[model samples]
Target: MPLMRIQLDSDRQTARRVVELHRTGKVHRESRDAARAEVWRRGRTPAGETVFVGTTNGEPVRLIYDVEVYRDVTA
Candidate 1:
Protein backbone atom coordinates (compact mmCIF):
# COMPACT_ATOMS: atom_id res chain seq x y z
CA MET A 1 0.00 0.00 0.00
CA PRO A 2 1.08 3.58 -0.62
CA LEU A 3 2.40 5.49 2.42
CA MET A 4 2.86 9.15 3.31
CA ARG A 5 6.67 8.79 3.40
CA ILE A 6 8.00 10.49 6.53
CA GLN A 7 11.07 10.35 8.76
CA LEU A 8 10.99 7.48 11.23
CA ASP A 9 14.41 7.70 12.84
CA SER A 10 12.99 7.53 16.36
CA ASP A 11 11.10 4.37 15.60
CA ARG A 12 14.30 2.43 14.99
CA GLN A 13 14.17 1.10 18.53
CA THR A 14 10.54 0.05 18.15
CA ALA A 15 11.29 -1.60 14.83
CA ARG A 16 14.10 -3.57 16.45
CA ARG A 17 11.76 -4.59 19.23
CA VAL A 18 9.15 -5.65 16.70
CA VAL A 19 11.72 -7.75 14.93
CA GLU A 20 12.72 -9.40 18.18
CA LEU A 21 9.08 -10.11 18.90
CA HIS A 22 8.70 -11.76 15.53
CA ARG A 23 11.91 -13.77 15.93
CA THR A 24 10.79 -15.06 19.33
CA GLY A 25 7.31 -15.84 18.00
CA LYS A 26 5.78 -13.18 20.17
CA VAL A 27 4.27 -11.60 17.05
CA HIS A 28 3.50 -12.95 13.61
CA ARG A 29 4.69 -11.62 10.28
CA GLU A 30 1.15 -10.70 9.30
CA SER A 31 0.78 -8.70 12.49
CA ARG A 32 4.03 -6.91 11.86
CA ASP A 33 3.00 -6.10 8.32
CA ALA A 34 -0.30 -4.75 9.47
CA ALA A 35 1.41 -2.71 12.12
CA ARG A 36 3.75 -1.25 9.54
CA ALA A 37 0.89 -0.46 7.22
CA GLU A 38 -0.92 1.23 10.05
CA VAL A 39 2.19 3.19 10.94
CA TRP A 40 2.45 4.39 7.40
CA ARG A 41 -1.16 5.40 7.09
CA ARG A 42 -1.94 6.61 10.57
CA GLY A 43 1.56 7.85 11.31
CA ARG A 44 1.45 6.53 14.83
CA THR A 45 0.24 3.69 17.07
CA PRO A 46 -3.36 3.24 18.15
CA ALA A 47 -2.71 5.02 21.42
CA GLY A 48 -1.44 8.17 19.73
CA GLU A 49 2.24 7.43 20.35
CA THR A 50 4.83 8.28 17.72
CA VAL A 51 6.23 5.44 15.59
CA PHE A 52 8.71 5.13 12.76
CA VAL A 53 9.33 2.76 9.87
CA GLY A 54 10.72 2.48 6.36
CA THR A 55 8.08 3.83 4.01
CA THR A 56 6.86 2.50 0.72
CA ASN A 57 8.27 5.64 -0.87
CA GLY A 58 11.65 4.83 0.66
CA GLU A 59 11.29 7.36 3.43
CA PRO A 60 10.45 7.36 7.14
CA VAL A 61 7.14 8.45 8.67
CA ARG A 62 6.04 9.29 12.16
CA LEU A 63 3.34 7.00 13.51
CA ILE A 64 0.38 8.61 15.24
CA TYR A 65 -0.67 5.87 17.63
CA ASP A 66 0.54 3.39 20.21
CA VAL A 67 1.05 -0.30 19.53
CA GLU A 68 -0.68 -2.85 21.69
CA VAL A 69 1.50 -5.05 23.92
CA TYR A 70 0.23 -8.41 25.13
CA ARG A 71 3.25 -9.34 27.20
CA ASP A 72 2.98 -9.51 30.95
CA VAL A 73 3.86 -6.23 32.58
CA THR A 74 3.44 -7.14 36.25
CA ALA A 75 6.76 -8.90 36.45
Candidate 2:
Protein backbone atom coordinates (compact mmCIF):
# COMPACT_ATOMS: atom_id res chain seq x y z
CA MET A 1 0.00 0.00 0.00
CA PRO A 2 1.28 3.44 -0.82
CA LEU A 3 1.87 5.56 2.24
CA MET A 4 -0.07 8.78 2.64
CA ARG A 5 1.68 11.91 3.77
CA ILE A 6 0.18 13.45 6.89
CA GLN A 7 1.68 16.76 7.87
CA LEU A 8 1.34 18.47 11.18
CA ASP A 9 2.40 21.88 12.35
CA SER A 10 5.96 22.17 13.59
CA ASP A 11 5.02 22.94 17.15
CA ARG A 12 5.06 21.22 20.54
CA GLN A 13 1.31 21.56 20.98
CA THR A 14 0.61 19.60 17.80
CA ALA A 15 2.90 16.80 18.93
CA ARG A 16 1.21 16.67 22.31
CA ARG A 17 -2.20 16.60 20.64
CA VAL A 18 -1.24 13.57 18.58
CA VAL A 19 -0.21 11.73 21.75
CA GLU A 20 -3.39 12.72 23.49
CA LEU A 21 -5.49 11.51 20.56
CA HIS A 22 -3.60 8.25 20.55
CA ARG A 23 -4.24 7.70 24.26
CA THR A 24 -7.96 8.20 23.66
CA GLY A 25 -7.86 5.57 20.90
CA LYS A 26 -8.74 8.17 18.33
CA VAL A 27 -5.45 7.47 16.56
CA HIS A 28 -3.47 4.26 16.25
CA ARG A 29 0.22 3.91 17.00
CA GLU A 30 0.84 2.16 13.72
CA SER A 31 -0.53 5.12 11.83
CA ARG A 32 1.51 7.54 13.89
CA ASP A 33 4.70 5.48 13.56
CA ALA A 34 4.28 5.04 9.85
CA ALA A 35 4.04 8.76 9.48
CA ARG A 36 7.01 9.41 11.73
CA ALA A 37 9.20 6.86 9.99
CA GLU A 38 8.51 8.32 6.58
CA VAL A 39 9.43 11.76 7.83
CA TRP A 40 12.70 10.50 9.27
CA ARG A 41 13.50 8.54 6.15
CA ARG A 42 13.19 11.56 3.89
CA GLY A 43 14.65 14.02 6.39
CA ARG A 44 13.23 17.48 6.94
CA THR A 45 11.95 19.27 3.89
CA PRO A 46 12.80 22.85 2.97
CA ALA A 47 9.43 23.91 4.38
CA GLY A 48 10.49 22.64 7.82
CA GLU A 49 7.24 20.73 8.18
CA THR A 50 6.62 17.74 10.42
CA VAL A 51 4.90 15.02 8.45
CA PHE A 52 3.41 11.65 9.29
CA VAL A 53 2.80 9.00 6.66
CA GLY A 54 -0.02 6.52 7.19
CA THR A 55 -2.10 4.09 5.18
CA THR A 56 -5.33 2.26 5.92
CA ASN A 57 -6.61 -0.49 3.60
CA GLY A 58 -4.64 1.14 0.79
CA GLU A 59 -6.51 4.38 1.20
CA PRO A 60 -4.91 7.74 1.84
CA VAL A 61 -6.12 9.94 4.66
CA ARG A 62 -4.90 13.24 6.03
CA LEU A 63 -4.70 13.79 9.78
CA ILE A 64 -4.89 17.28 11.13
CA TYR A 65 -2.68 18.46 13.94
CA ASP A 66 -5.43 19.92 16.10
CA VAL A 67 -7.62 16.86 16.01
CA GLU A 68 -10.55 16.65 18.37
CA VAL A 69 -12.31 13.46 19.34
CA TYR A 70 -15.97 13.68 18.63
CA ARG A 71 -18.42 11.00 19.63
CA ASP A 72 -21.11 9.88 17.28
CA VAL A 73 -24.21 11.89 17.97
CA THR A 74 -26.57 9.49 16.25
CA ALA A 75 -25.81 5.83 16.61
Candidate 3:
Protein backbone atom coordinates (compact mmCIF):
# COMPACT_ATOMS: atom_id res chain seq x y z
CA MET A 1 0.00 0.00 0.00
CA PRO A 2 1.30 3.39 -0.98
CA LEU A 3 1.16 6.32 1.37
CA MET A 4 -1.13 9.06 0.17
CA ARG A 5 -0.87 12.62 1.34
CA ILE A 6 -3.81 14.99 1.27
CA GLN A 7 -2.85 18.63 1.13
CA LEU A 8 -5.13 21.12 2.78
CA ASP A 9 -4.81 24.78 3.60
CA SER A 10 -5.13 24.26 7.34
CA ASP A 11 -8.91 24.11 7.19
CA ARG A 12 -10.27 21.38 9.48
CA GLN A 13 -13.86 21.94 8.42
CA THR A 14 -13.09 21.27 4.77
CA ALA A 15 -10.96 18.31 5.73
CA ARG A 16 -13.79 16.78 7.74
CA ARG A 17 -16.30 17.29 4.95
CA VAL A 18 -13.99 15.56 2.51
CA VAL A 19 -13.61 12.65 4.89
CA GLU A 20 -17.38 12.31 5.10
CA LEU A 21 -17.75 12.48 1.34
CA HIS A 22 -15.19 9.73 0.94
CA ARG A 23 -16.89 7.55 3.52
CA THR A 24 -20.29 7.69 1.76
CA GLY A 25 -18.81 6.97 -1.71
CA LYS A 26 -19.68 10.43 -2.88
CA VAL A 27 -16.26 10.86 -4.57
CA HIS A 28 -12.86 9.30 -5.17
CA ARG A 29 -9.38 10.55 -4.41
CA GLU A 30 -7.55 8.71 -7.13
CA SER A 31 -6.99 11.66 -9.48
CA ARG A 32 -4.16 13.99 -8.51
CA ASP A 33 -4.95 17.19 -6.65
CA ALA A 34 -4.14 19.19 -9.79
CA ALA A 35 -6.87 17.43 -11.71
CA ARG A 36 -9.28 17.17 -8.79
CA ALA A 37 -8.93 20.83 -7.91
CA GLU A 38 -11.05 21.72 -10.92
CA VAL A 39 -13.90 19.58 -9.70
CA TRP A 40 -13.51 20.92 -6.18
CA ARG A 41 -13.62 24.46 -7.47
CA ARG A 42 -17.05 23.70 -8.83
CA GLY A 43 -18.28 22.54 -5.44
CA ARG A 44 -17.19 25.50 -3.37
CA THR A 45 -19.20 26.05 -0.24
CA PRO A 46 -20.42 29.39 1.04
CA ALA A 47 -17.22 29.52 3.07
CA GLY A 48 -15.22 29.55 -0.17
CA GLU A 49 -13.58 26.21 0.57
CA THR A 50 -12.96 23.91 -2.37
CA VAL A 51 -13.37 20.22 -1.60
CA PHE A 52 -11.34 17.87 -3.80
CA VAL A 53 -11.72 14.09 -3.82
CA GLY A 54 -9.00 11.70 -5.01
CA THR A 55 -8.08 8.04 -4.67
CA THR A 56 -4.98 6.81 -2.92
CA ASN A 57 -3.54 3.30 -3.17
CA GLY A 58 -5.90 0.37 -3.23
CA GLU A 59 -7.41 -1.39 -6.21
CA PRO A 60 -8.89 -0.54 -9.58
CA VAL A 61 -12.47 -0.63 -8.35
CA ARG A 62 -11.90 -0.10 -4.65
CA LEU A 63 -9.31 2.59 -4.04
CA ILE A 64 -8.81 4.68 -0.92
CA TYR A 65 -8.70 8.41 -1.55
CA ASP A 66 -7.44 11.41 0.29
CA VAL A 67 -9.33 14.66 0.26
CA GLU A 68 -7.23 17.71 -0.50
CA VAL A 69 -9.50 20.05 1.33
CA TYR A 70 -8.52 23.68 0.93
CA ARG A 71 -9.76 27.14 0.21
CA ASP A 72 -9.40 28.02 -3.42
CA VAL A 73 -11.11 31.36 -3.10
CA THR A 74 -11.53 33.98 -0.40
CA ALA A 75 -14.07 36.70 0.18
Best by lDDT: 2
TM-score of each: 0.29, 0.29, 0.30
The Cα local distance difference test for each model comes to 0.42, 0.43, 0.41
| Per-residue lDDT of model 3, residues 36-55, tens digit only | 45435657323232244443
- Pairs with backbone N, CA or C atoms under 3 Å apart (clashes), candidate 2: 35-52, 35-53
Off by over 4 Å in 3: 1-6, 28-75
Better of 1 and 3 by TM-score: 3
Q: Model 2 TM-score?
A: 0.29
Model 1 agreement with the true structure over 1-75: per-residue lDDT tens digits: 123333333254565565566456565354345555655475443333223332222235232223542233355
lDDT of 2 by residue, 6-41 (tens): 553334544556567756657645545555555556
Tell me the lDDT of candidate 3.
0.41
